[model samples]
Target chain A: MKFKQYLPASSSDGKAMVSLKDGGTLGDLLDTLGIPPDVPKLVIINGISRGVSNTVNAETLTDGDVVAIFPPSGGG
Target chain B: MEAWMGKILRVNLSYGDYHIEEIDPDYLRPYLGGRGLGSKILYDEVDPQVDPFSPENKLIFMTGPLTGTGAPCSSRYMVITKSPLSGTIACSNSGGFFGPELKFAGYDGIIFEGVADEPVYLWINDDEVEIRSAAEFWGKTTHETEDFIRAKIENKYLAKEIRVASIGPAGEKLSRIACVINDKNRAAGRSGVGAVMGSKKLKAIAVRGTGKIMLPDKEAFHKAVLHARDVIRAGPVTGEALPAYGTAVLVNIINEAKILPTNNWQVTYFETANKIAGETIAETILKRPKGCFACPIACGRLTEISDPQNTGMGSPKYFKGEGPEYETVELMGASCGIDNLAAITKANYLCNEMGMDTISAAATVATAMELYEKGYLPEKDLGLKANFGNADALIILTEKMGKREGIGDIMAEGGYRLAEQYGHPELFMGVKKLEAPAYDPRGVQSMGLQYATSNRGACHVRGYAIANEILGVHVKTDPLITEGKAEMVKTFQDITAVIDSSGLCLFVALATNFLYEEIQSLINAASGAGYTVDELVSIGERISNLERLFNLKAGLTKADDTLPKRLLEEPGGPKGDVCRLNEMLPEYYQLRGWDENGVPTTDKLSGLGLQ
Candidate 1:
């Protein structure tokens, strides 16, 4: 799996390659990355926003899927 | 008489006199001060077709009811006038101590009318007002002008308390992109509002007020304020991300989304964007985080550049100042193809000191660079090789543009005129006549429609659809899709209008779970107007329609509501999608209760009480 993380606490390099079982859910990926469940985040799976809320863990993930995680952030 | 000062100081420069006028109570709830109230005054007082530089044009400095009331991010004020660049209704909002200080000085706003025969600056110490000669400070930079004025005050303590809003040489020279600088750095930037002030030969307005703003229901106001503060403090975006990295945090995110405009929109992403991103600034030259009055987010950056090698040619090796906000970094750094953070920071300082809009100034230079690259602009006229990524050229051209010298003189007219002179208006990359900011709308589909319909030409803050389209704020929307974008754009625009009129920073909207209900509660307690959430939103619609009516009267037609040809026809972004403005505009007009030609229907105007 290809992962991009924008949270400073989660990943220092912002990009990572992870191995996941087939039919794994997004909750599994967050658990593996040691991301806290209560922290607000925006999860994008393959360029589409899965959710920005805490319930994004319900999203199902598959092999070769791209997941980008962003902290609550905005622009001017 | 709660929240609002309930008085306006009208200064007629031609006669060297002033008068105090009472603000009508009936206008307060609907207009709500700042942009809304100021625009109403402008529409009623000035002829729409009057030349922006003429003495007939009036410049208004207005503050909202929440201003100086200890409300979060209540440090904003609006400068309303006709834009010399776009000829549209200009209402440039700025944040600093100046707006609050003006309120404390016993006036809600100031109306500047007619031109002075000589350069002058206004001084208000409570009721003591004077139009002093500005001959000594006329050609000075904004910093120098402030210092000169402060030094002239015999009472040092009073001088220190005084907050001044002044123009630099750029405004004095009447550059189309010149902005008004307050508190030495914060600017009422964009739309050439400073040029209007310059035409009046009024250099600055220094105010020191000792009065407190009265509130009708202090207990209720405090209750609402404390709750809002808690919500803002807990927000992931507002409380943490913004205070930690400032607005430049978006540099990486937007670039990753492949929507960060680079090389003046010729490209959609910058490979070296990380060099100037917020993370890099935090790791490097950032001195500290700064905030305006009552601003918990503190998104402002206090930064310094000490490396001699990184500084631009003929610029200082060591300098400390307040920004290079996200727009500045993108437009002047990545958009101009120069990723040197130090150079970008120095250029930002120059813009602040010289009183120019960094967005338009940088976009104009980017246009010149493209013109030169295409062989349409001769090097003889430029006096140097104006190429993309030329840091020295960026700095040199910025200073020249401020002074209106050589090739900079042509650029001072703005990107539209600069490109039109070079025979490619299509290459200007703006709507109406004002240059667009840093976003590449081709990637964020709704932003294109936002840009097209903004009352002030091509402004992101007017309707930041990027919040939904890219950042996933409020609701996540597909950036590449056209479906439902029009309704989304209208809603964002209306909400934005309410925020702008409230004297609160738009960044507050980024807070997770914060919505119009919270805003309505704050406004009700602060102003004692008791508006419902829907009514507050309707007031925003009223303001939008009023400004649109003014623009239509100012000679703007449906045709002017458009993006650049490049955005519409040329493909860009990672997906190579062009901005489908046509797909969204008709629906937007319908949502706005406007006709197919983009004119507000009589029913819509009457419903909003504009009739």
Candidate 2:
């Protein structure tokens, strides 16, 4: 299985996929994703995450596992 | 008398008159104040047929009942006028300390009419008002104007915090899309209100008021304000995203939705969006977060752009300025097919300096670029080798537009007129005479509907339906859906009208008021009055109807409820489908209790208390 997330503010599209070894939970995957805790808002798996402890569905993840993350936005 | 000064400052330039008028209590109850109250006055007093740039047209700057009352984010003021760009009623709202200052100065509104014989600026201290010569400030930028006003006044007891709303060369040149800027680089920055001020020969408004502004119920208001600020600080949008990266953060999300207008609304996707994304700004250029008066959520940024070229190795000077807000980024960056954030920020400074609206400026530049590409507009017309992605064209033409010189002369006229002048009127992408924002309606269905019927001509603040379509706040609806958008647009419009009228910035409602019902509570807390969600929504409908009545008087008909040819006939993205504006307009009209032709019925008008 693989985990992918984007740091939108940095223009980092998270197009690079990370392969997770068997038996890794979302927490481990989130940890490996390496989003700094101090980075106020993170679009973790299409949801806002204040902490990296947010769980991802590592079990459902497979090769080419693509998850898009977004930061909070304003100025409409 | 607790918070509101309950007075109006009237300035007539043509006759050289300045007087103070007591506000009508009845008008305040129904309209609530700010943009809403201003719209009601414009609809009732002025003839709709009056020319927008004429001395006959009155420009009303108003604040809400809650303004300067210690209510959270109730620091915004509105500029209401018949827009020179749209030829319809315009209400552009902005956040700052000026609203509070005006309240302290014992006035609820400032109404100006007629043209002065020469350049002049308004000076208000408490109950005192004066119009002084602005010969020294005739050609200065907005920034310079503010500095000059502060320097000349030199009032030590006034706290050195005189808030000034002024224009740049663009407004003096009467560009259709000039903006009124204040503290924190906040702006009533959409329509041509700046041009109206220019036409009146007004240079700037400098206000200093020390009278304590109080809410009707100070204890209640303070508690409510605290709650609202907490909500703002706790919300994800305000707490995390905006504080971390400011408004420019939306660059990637809108691009992901594939709705970010790229290269003149032709492409939804931009490969260069990453280059100008929010994170890049925060990392490379962002210096510190800037904020408006009494706002805890300081989403504004004071930034400096330094690069390898500015390492004293290449350019002698580096660019430093206030922004590249999301709209400026998308409009100036992606829409014009320019991805450089530093370049976009520089252009923003130019817009502010020249008194231009970045949204309209970028959109017009894109229109001009499209013309150049089609060979309809010669390169010589622009006084340069004009093309998209050419940063030089963006920088120089902005200055020209400020001065209304050369190609900038025609470009300053706005997209619709510029296209009309070249005999290819279809090239213009706007509703009425004003240019559209960064969102291409084809991608976001509700936006298309909103733009089609917007009284002020293609404004986003009227109803920002994009949050639902793209950001998926509350409930996510498919961005491609046309059905039921009538209700969505109406609902969004009504909610926003209340927000604008209340004197709070919209960001508070969107990011802070996560639970929809909390918005009503917050307003209740500040006003010390209670209303069901229904009454608030009705206010929105009423404001819309009022604006419609004003526009009808301005000679707009069902024909005016239209999308540009490009949005209606040519869809460019994956679906290649044009906006079904025809299908949406009728439903929107029906929802607003209007006739099939988009005119407000007499009954509807009467219900809203319109004359």
Chain A only: TM-score per candidate: 0.71, 0.42
After aligning candidate 2 to the native by TM-score, how far in Å is the CA of B327 from where it should be?
A: 0.8
- Interface-residue RMSD per candidate? 3.9, 7.0
Clashes of 2: 2
DockQ of all models, two decimals each: 0.36, 0.24
Please write out the lDDT profile of model 1 over residues B1-611, one tens digit for every residue.
Answer: 68889999999999999999999888777888888999999999999999999999999999988888888888999999999999999999999999999999999999999999999999999989889999988999899899999999999999899999999989999999999999999999999999999999999999999998988888999999999999898987788888988999888778877787888888887879889988888888899999999999999999988877545323556678888899998888888899988888888888999999999999999999899888989999999998999998988899899999999998999999999999999889889889998888888888899899999989899988887787776777888899999998888888888888888878778876677888888888987877888788898899999999999999999999999988998898757989999999999999889999999999999999999
Query: Candidate 1's C-alpha lDDT?
Result: 0.88
DockQ of 2: 0.24
Q: RMSD, each candidate, Å? A: 2.8, 4.4
Residue-level lDDT tens digits of model 2 in B1-611: 34456788888888777899887766666676787889988877789999888888999999976677766676889999998888899899888788888988888889998899999999888877888899898888887888787777655655377889998788888888888887636788988889999888898998988787555566776677677778878876777678777887788767766677887787877878878877778777788988777777788888876653322111347655678788888888888888877777777777877788888888888888888888988877877876878766777777677778898898898888888887788877778877888777776788988888888888788888876666655455666768889899988888788888877787776663444355566666655556577767677778878888888878999998888887888765435667888778888888787898887777877776664
Computed on alpha carbons, the lDDT of every model, listed in order, comes to: 0.88, 0.76
lDDT of 2 at B554: 83
User: Which regions of candidate 2 deviate over 4 angstroms?
Assistant: A1-14, A18-67, B154-159, B306-319, B512-524, B527-532
Clashing pairs for model 1 are none
Worst 10 residues of 2 chain B by lDDT: B307-316
Q: How good is the docking of model 1, by CAPRI class?
A: acceptable
